[model samples]
Target: MRRQGIAPLPFAQGLALLDAVLARPAGNFVPARLDLREAQHAADAGEEVPALFRALVRRNTRPARARTSVTSAPTGLRDRLLAAPAEERIELVTQLVLREVAAVLGLDSADSLAPDQVLKHLGLDSLMAVELRRGLSAATELSLPATLAFDYPTPEEIAKLILTRLDLPTTPEATPASAASDAPGDATDSEALLGWALERLSADQLRRSGLLDRLVELARESAPAPEGTATVPAPAEPAGTLDDERSVDDINAELNALLEASGFDLD
Candidate 1:
């Protein structure tokens, strides 16, 4: 199965191997000899077969193992798994578990993992599942149930369990990209509603539409004035504004200007 867009089996490499075999001279055809050569040649051929095997390994290896240097999280994330606040800790733990799972399978990133995505669906077999359970158990410093990962089937479910076991709030954090049902209990909050609206506007779409800069401007405009200062309402028509008052042409012009400033050539 494919996980995080990575195919576990090297079908291409296998096909290449077959192609190389077929492309070789026809007289090399003895399977028994080939088997014997594979079995006996390691000791007899010494450097010859070993060199070929090493070359194959090098050629077939994934890019994940090609790294000579490793960069760690800026916040010492792996170490502070249990030390961060409830919401933060949950996100970190979920991220960590997902990363570890991805690592075991030689996957690139856990961002490919969704909160509701099942472990098994991501090319996880029984052994991988057990390994994930064990790793998460050690990471969280908890004697987690053996079937924890398999049973929950999803990161969010497992994360909520982790939070509950740790006596932390299991309530989900509200973010623009996350589901609107993040906090079922606080569904009516106006801020959450606004966040939900923002979430509906994807970053790329917002940027391409020039709504992101406008949204930022609107936020700056709506910010509360400092206390104890005489409240003076700003002029209704302010310069460099991107509010609803701006027409499509004006917004498009502003977008073009911003794009040009950012070295984005649309022409």
Candidate 2:
């Protein structure tokens, strides 16, 4: 585009430019597809695109910084795991591992995985293994090896490793479930058995397990307001007055104020 005399947009400004254009009703009519060469010409010479670029430039001078770390999981997960009783700790870790594995495999439910099925048999490759390890590391705040799936082979085995790495208490007597025969069938069957076991647990144990927090999150996700029913459109910007229109130099004085109003933060 620069070779064609088009100004290169800084990443943040480019995003702001997109938002500014999309705010207009005419923006919805923008073409869904365009020849690459023609798109470059349109960006370079189009009146609307240039005007929006000016507005975005007048809004911010600094570019946004890139993120420096992985997105973190919900706070206090490790602490919660530590506080839970031995049996419930095992259950929580098992559930967490199952969910992560299902997500990697694009399965609809975590229970779709069997506790004893080898990960390779379930189609987990090296890259998927690394992705799963990254997710588990973030969620559990533990340093998991890159070859996690190959070593553990199953969700149940991975869960046990995570618990061991976290140094979570699991005395054999305290965790009778560890000694019991593996539940017959898939993770769903095991979950059903777990449900029966939970009925015998105290409310305090359930709370410390973080099961209630998980349930609340699931409930909130499942009960979203109907789409379009609660949709709210952005209010239209008022016409600029003589004072509102300013030269480039004067605009810099109002840059932060304008970007704040438009919901962009360059810093």
Best by lDDT: 2
- Per-residue lDDT for 156-188 in model 1, tens only? 788778766766434445445555455445766
lDDT (Cα) of model 2: 0.62
lDDT tens readout by residue for model 2, 56-162: 33222345466676655434667677667667887788888889898888789987777778999988988778879978998988899878899889988999998
Candidate 2, superposed: residue stretches over 4 Å from native? 1-75, 169-267
TM-score of each: 0.34, 0.37
Each model's lDDT: 0.58, 0.62
Candidate 1 lDDT (Cα, 0 to 1): 0.58
Which parts of model 1 are misplaced by more than 4 Å? 1-83, 168-267
